[model samples]
Target: MTSPSDAPEGTEPGTEPGTEPGTEPGTVRPGGRTARVRAAVLEAAGDMLAEQGFHGLDLAEVARRAEVGKTTVYRRWGTVAGLVADLLTDMAEQSLPRAETGSLEGDLLANARLVRRTLSDPRQGPLFRAVIAAATGDARTAEALHRFYEVRVAEWAPCVREAVERGELPAGTDAAEVVRAVSAPLYYRLLTTDAPLDEDAARRAAAAAVAAARAGAFVRTP
Candidate 1:
């Protein structure tokens, strides 16, 4: 959600990024000039969110910062919520894929460390805090945030499934819950405490989740 570059010239304006010429906007396949515009606009939006928060996000300012036409921004993104939602979508799409470390503990630790790094990053951390704060009072932003996490959680769920297959965890372990468990304490610490998210913290979170899953804490009961 944090990086964006300038849009190149010579493409049709106002078309959504990554949309095909003959297709509807949301049908969305990536290419060409529109992607550049999207990149620029999203970058501007992210910067603004990090600097000024959701209340400070202005479409005109975003358009000016991105060097994109104001009309194009209005036409494509419509509202602040829409723009923020797209930013989340882009972030999810740009995020790293799941780690395949061949063991539940390794994969969960990787997941924990990734969360720590992201939540600890200067730009990303503030951006997340702003979005999360905005989401508390905004339904659209909340939905977008939920979707973003859903995508991420789904990406890592397989590690728990694999652990179950290997009999390292009980049968019917709730894979998503196990994955969430690995990250929950980290987020709680991020929001509730002033402690450092060191590697040791990541390791501890992963270890605790693994222990819990092995104890059937995350097993689905009928």
Candidate 2:
């Protein structure tokens, strides 16, 4: 008979490798062996996505690189789309919190800089491009991508709300829209041009969002 430790890479008798003991198979725990396996898998997935784009992402390859069992990867993520969805979810969870700069400008600038830095990062930049490209033709991937942005926007929307409370912007300002405005140009520039994402570009993006907000452009209609 096999011992618990010898059950398998993903199966430990009492607990699943990627999920908590006695919990649902797909439920993610915060830490422990499960978390470590998840981290390893995600890291491998991101690396592959960065190096060869979505088409090159293979579950077996990811398991091999992560030193986990292929069975584990398949059981946890199921498909390439599933893996990418989990990857995006992990990215959103691990992303930086909203900046608490006293003024709205300061907060927007910080948000803009963070976005620029992420898009300009060697690994992150390529990973994002690959995911975005993958989403273009895949409905599931597109939904996951949209959820990823929604999570990010929700994280920063509070800053805009605070600005409104401070009377920096008009009442009924759509905080989500304001946050989106700050990131839109940076993403556009990243996808549309070969230009460097310099500090100036970040500042400009933040300034433009603030200007628009102050001018009541993001105000919601009754």
Candidate 3:
């Protein structure tokens, strides 16, 4: 299993794949001081998730890491699971808009590339594994994990459905399933093996998914 890194830096959950936060205006806009505090808290939570695993996560510890008041952490996030759920929301909001690469192949590749980039990060990959392991034990964590992936898949599924509408793919294609296909192998690699989740693998997965979907893999056959 990939372990979370301590003080290891990678892309922020809310930022674009290649771009950092604060570089793009509409990418993320913290509304007020409280929102900023919440962001800091979530970052600290992410760090904790990667390094300590969820069972070891403490709101007070997160507050200390974020340099915020313990009361503030409790007030905002309520509990460790609550805090993690909110952090998942923050991560969803920060992910970049779906790529509009025109062709289904291009769009799928874009989606795969983005997933690979994020999950392959030095910090993020391990943190994800830790949280996933936590999810197996904690119902709340499992729900949060489900929501995180659901949001991500939804963000990218439109491209596939749009392709079908445009006649690039068969009608009645399962957009969400198509999107999942692109990342399924990457996750399998991340979970089952010690192989690096590399760019080539991401591209190949995307290509295969797009090709398979075009062949009606997601179509409802009579």
Candidate 4:
């Protein structure tokens, strides 16, 4: 559960030393007291969600755990939904960049592996499950979760686009759909079964996605 502030240099957007608009209120700038406090609060919020799910999240508890003023948390994030939205935003910003492997299969394999890693990670797995469960009944949380997936899908869509350009996939392939295809089954397995997400599962996911893309299953209809 590494916070965005703790991410290595150049790994995440807006990590450099400067102000960036649309960041969480207290995190307008990076590498300062404000940024540190923001990181602490978000970390505490994530921990609470991972441990007790979103229904258990409390702003006062988060502030106490973060050792920051309760007023600051309330003022900055207003509500639990707002805080969870910012947490999902931070997670999206902190995600790894897409792989640039030459072939479509290789690139898809890399993408599948990344998804597998995140869904299989101890901290991230529980955190995602909690967020997803919360989203089921919370409109704001659902919107935030959708946005998070949109960002991730956009980040990886270029791989499928490149495959199309290289004639590895059918022309007019829907890149986003192809990328989502690689993750759909993995997520289903994660939510439904108690099976372990092994490398074999990742490879199969990638292979299926590649087969679909090559067969024009992802082609966009006019």
Ranking of predictions according to lDDT = 2, 4, 1, 3
Each model's C-alpha lDDT?
Answer: 0.86, 0.89, 0.80, 0.87
Please give, for residues 41-144, the per-residue lDDT of candidate 1 as tens digits: 89999999999999999999999999998876876677898889889999999999999999988999999999999999989988998999999999989999
Clashing pairs in 1: none
Instruction: Please provide TM-scores, in order, for all candidate models, with all chains considered together.
Output: 0.88, 0.90, 0.83, 0.87
Looking at model 2, the pairs that clash are none
When 2 and 3 are scored with TM-score, the better candidate is 2
TM-score of 1: 0.88
1-222: candidate 2 lDDT, tens digit per residue: 235766657666644544555553333654687788889999999999999999999999999999998877876777888889888989998999999989999999999999999999999999999999999988888988999999999999999999999999999999999999999999999999999999999999999999999999999998
List ranges where model 1 is wrong by over 4 Å.
1-30
Q: lDDT tens digits, residues 1-222, model 4? A: 235676446545333334343555433435676678779999999999988999999999999999997876775677899889889988999999999989999999999999999999988998999999999999988999999999999999998898888889889999999999999999999999999999999999999999988999988999
Top model number, lDDT: 2
Error in Å for residue 186 of model 1: 1.0
* Worst 10-residue lDDT window, candidate 2: 18-27
Name the candidate that leads on TM-score: 2
Worst 10 residues of 1 by lDDT: 1-10
Which lDDT value does model 3 have at 207? 90
Q: How many pairs in model 3 have backbone atoms within 3 A of each other, for residues 3 or more apart or on separate chains, i.e. clashes?
A: 2
Alpha-carbon deviation at 1 in model 1, angstroms: 28
- Please write out the lDDT profile of model 3 over residues 1-222, one tens digit for every residue: 112332125745433223344552222334556567777888999998888888779999999999987765664456787777777777888988898978898999999988898889877887888888888887987888899889999999889888988998999898999999999999898999998888899989999998899898999667
